[model samples]
Target: MYNKGTIIPGLVIFIVFVTFPLWYNGLNAGTVPKPDLPIGQKECVAPAAEMRDNHMKLLNEWRDAVLREDDRVMVKVGGKEYRKGLQMACMQCHNDKEKFCDSCHTYAAVQPTCWDCHLTPKEAASKKETH
Candidate 1:
């Protein structure tokens, strides 16, 4: 049989590295996915489930429509229509991107470059307020 001392240390190291992600996430996990609604807000333009699951997709579509195609049209879902602009529509309710966007993004360990182009209302307001 192989040496138990070497086998145990190697096994322990393997498990630690393998489970590092889980432990790290657990340590950092907190009330991220809680109600990220603005004060006194009722509902989003799209449903919460759709927004949570497919926000990036919708953003990509919006980017393409706005930038590449120049096709700024109304987005209709569930018998409701919204003008397709991140800065115009989304930031209306989700103005606090640090709380809403950063919370979920941090939990999921994804670094979305949404703010690279589209500025949050708070940030824009700060700019306007300062200048």
Candidate 2:
């Protein structure tokens, strides 16, 4: 081939570019974040593993049920009734958003929009005090 030298170097460059991310990241997945679980709170609306994977879907469903269908959206688990929403339920137990929510969210590189509308427990209390 007349372009042997150029073709070989071009192929090398292409392969390096294609695999750049793996090389840069060292093929290491990253450390899993362990959020601080609530003390003395054993049960949840769903199991731990289920919630880790599908909390967003559950929250969206709850929102739809409460707003669209006019349902009260109360979920009972382990004899405790929980109102379906971030503020009323999830934040009640996971009160420290930075410790409980932010840890895992940051590790997963996600920006959850839940805080956009609902004030965190600490924020709500502080706002009430200010007013």
Candidate 3:
């Protein structure tokens, strides 16, 4: 290893660059976001843990079912029928999107596409009121 003087330092620099993020973040997964729960509503379409992990997947399935199969698709949970949609079903209870949705999503560093098509309940109401 005739080039050990330059090669060893180069290898060290490369390793540090590769592992910098892991060290900077202390291998610490960020704190779990504490989203505000819906008031006067004790249950969601799915259980809390399932929803936390797979809400996007569930929403995508709901979107497919509603758009491809039927617009009036209803989901029955805990003896209640909900018209499958972000606005119609989910937002009925989780009206404050900033508090309920944004908190968790921001922590997870995701930008959901749902808002591209639908307004938050508060926004919809404000627009309706102005009109």
Candidate 4:
């Protein structure tokens, strides 16, 4: 009877500690679809274009803010202040490369070799060896 209770507790422990994080990470790595716009709605109907334009404008503003040296919004890493770019911000909504990066890269016919040399901004390589 004690062994049976122990089995259930051990299984629960394994599920909570081991399986849960792996499942969470896997779920986080994939592309999350936008709730408002369902899949297969590629062609601009009318209002979508305006909304897209507005979104682009906001993105550009964010980019400009980061580019500005005077702007205090920055992340400090290894004693250097690095401005956050669009890629970092945008990835919050569109996490997968196929959903976000590939779409724009394909549209512009530009192949970005970023993944070859660079990890995501959050996981940037250590600068300790540079100096």
Candidate 5:
């Protein structure tokens, strides 16, 4: 027969080990990403949820349009035509890509390759200031 004293302590240890992450996260969870609206703009090219869910898909489409299709970079969403370039267009509003883009990407565990080919807002500003 199992001893009640040993069994109870073992069960408690097992439960705590299994649920440690839940308690830890609940106590010290990171906040969700919140991008600020660009100056003079009320809304983004697409809806908030749409952008959150499918921005990568949209970027791939844009890349194909520009790199493959030769500058057919117009994306019409929500009755407005947006030129699908990160530096030329999206950066105008989301100036701090590190805070806005990287924060969310980090939270979601996605490693976006944009920074490999693009300058961050801070980098772009410094480059401009030096000239």
Candidate 6:
């Protein structure tokens, strides 16, 4: 049997180690959204154009890195590299994909097909551990 004093320490540990992450993730989950370009910019014009260009550049770099099969760039867990496909999820870099991916997609009138095919990092990590 545990002492009453020990129970308080154990509860503190649980709150710090377990409940904190749950609360943190819950708060962050809603914070990710896509980029929002200026309104009425058909060709990604003006200041918004620069943002679009930068975004495309980043995406292209990511694509190129993946095509080169650069395992070194892959996401690491316990110092192990995950495969490219498994690592390509939006949250890998853009932790706020709801804010980053969705916001830009809405502005561009383009529906990202990511949700149609890909699982989120949280989901993927969970599945990975079970397997």
Evaluate all candidate structures by whole-model CA lDDT and list the values in order. 0.78, 0.85, 0.87, 0.53, 0.78, 0.55
lDDT of 5 by residue, 8-120 (tens): 99999999999999878987777877755566656777788898799889878777778798885665544566677887767767787777787777788989888888898
> Clash pairs of candidate 5?
none
> Candidate 6 residues 1-131, lDDT tens each?
56979998888998888778676777565543445432332332124457456755654565667767564355443344444442453344444455556675765577755566567656667899999
User: What TM-score, over all chains together, does every model reach?
Assistant: 0.74, 0.79, 0.79, 0.32, 0.71, 0.35
Q: Which ten residues in a row have the lowest lDDT in candidate 1?
A: 27-36
- Candidate 2: clashing residue pairs, number: 0
Give the per-residue lDDT digits (tens) of candidate 4, residues 1-131: 56988899988888788778676787565544443333433432225567455755654566567666545366443344444554554443344556555665565576655566545534443453454
Please write out the lDDT profile of model 1 over residues 1-131, one tens digit for every residue.
Answer: 58998999999999999999887878765564664677765677668789779989988888898889998888663455667788767776677888888876877799988878777777788899888
Per lDDT, the best of the predicted structures is 3
Candidate 1 accuracy as lDDT:
0.78
Tens digits of per-residue lDDT, candidate 2, 12-67, equal 99999999998998989777888989887898988999998999999888778877
Off by over 4 Å in 4: 1-51, 54-56, 72-88, 108-131
Question: What lDDT score goes with residue 45 in model 3?
Answer: 86
RMSD to the true structure for each prediction, in A, is 3.4, 2.4, 2.5, 17.6, 3.4, 18.4
Model 5: ten consecutive residues of lowest lDDT? 72-81
lDDT of 4 at 80: 40
RMSD from true fold, candidate 4:
17.6
